[model samples]
Target: MTAPTLRGAAAFVQQVRAAEQHLSGADPVMAAVIERHGPCTLGATRRDPFHTLCASIISQQLSSKAADTIQARLMAGIGAGRRITPPLLLAASHEELRGYGLSTAKARWLRALGEAAAAGTLDFRALGRLDDEAAIAVLDALPGIGRWTAEMFLMFALNRIDLFAMDDVGLRRGVAMLYNRGRPLSDARTLKITRRWAPYRTIASWYLWRVADPVNEIWV
Candidate 1:
């Protein structure tokens, strides 16, 4: 089966090959993961920046399943086209938005995002031009978006290859399980271990996420 299209995904095969080779050689633990997983087809997606950001906001504290369910309901509520564009969100009344299973706060966040997009303050393309930290800072300034969310947007939406969210539960778990052998993970230790996969950490992350089930894969 084909992979789901991810935003800012690799268009050049050379880089991906280099990433895999780097990870394989850098850490034996990651090498085992890559050998088992075969390839890193990080979840396929084709969402635009604004749409991806909206999804990220909805996903803030919810499980992937819960977030997907609410987003589905919201898109269905919007119309048959199923596009969550700024204009569509801006056109909906706040009450109408909440009725789609979003919390009152989430509704406001959606409105804020919409307002940003409509006002030209949220330029998706411009984000690509900024370095990861600067771009993350820009996104962090937005309501409801934090370092983690901005990192995600940069990694997935902007298709940056080097970012690694050290604080992410999954990455932390992956590190502990594969390298530490169930020992407690400290921030400094985690940084030391993961930095070896640097410059290709995102790809390394994909393999790490696969550690629990090398035979089957899911983006979460």
Candidate 2:
């Protein structure tokens, strides 16, 4: 099987800078966000498709810190010098998976993913050729993955530029804080604001994540 092409971390940063230049020119509100945050520092991890999907599954509806802990525990149990593959998860009983702090639903999803992988139903490589919406549809069809999770997979996993997930609470909060004085916008209004960030919305979304950070000082 051909390995998925992975970019060096530097390449992703270069893309961010390029995106920032466009964003700065296109939207002043976003320009302020860029000025405050400086460069986009969204790290590019070279995780394989299955591993990335597994992490995404683990992260669903959970806070980042909690999700990381659960993912770490499960990975540790998979043993040293081993990758997460179909059989490894297929061999894991649901009870064993739950012991790693996965909810019953998440554990079932993981096993379902394993089953799909083993059956050659979910072809990670094939996803590379599909357009964003198409790829998202395929992933969304999977038992537990939702539109938000699929959007995240495209943004973080595949590193597709220009993806925006309006339903994400953080992105919504970021949009509200920046453009609406911390008042939430309806999805339609939010979409209007995000449209100007297009073709670089992924990078824009990265800054939104920063703008919505509670620890960051309020924007003037």
The RMSD of every model to the true structure, in order and in angstroms, is 3.8, 4.0
Tell me which residue pairs clash in candidate 2: none
lDDT of 1 at 117: 91
lDDT tens digits, residues 50-152, model 1?
8878988888889777888989988888772646899888888899889988999999999999999999898876777888888989999999899998887
Task: Report the lDDT tens digits of candidate 2 across residue range 9-43.
Answer: 56666777899999999999889889987877554
Worst 10 residues of 2 by lDDT: 1-10
> For candidate 1, what's the RMSD?
3.8
Stretches of candidate 1 exceeding 4 Å from the true structure:
1-10, 80-82, 212-220
Top TM-score hit: 1
**Over 4 Å off in model 2, which ranges?**
1-13, 80-83, 214-220
| Model 1 per-residue lDDT at 50 | 84
Q: What is the C-alpha lDDT of each candidate?
A: 0.78, 0.81
How do all models score by TM-score? 0.89, 0.88
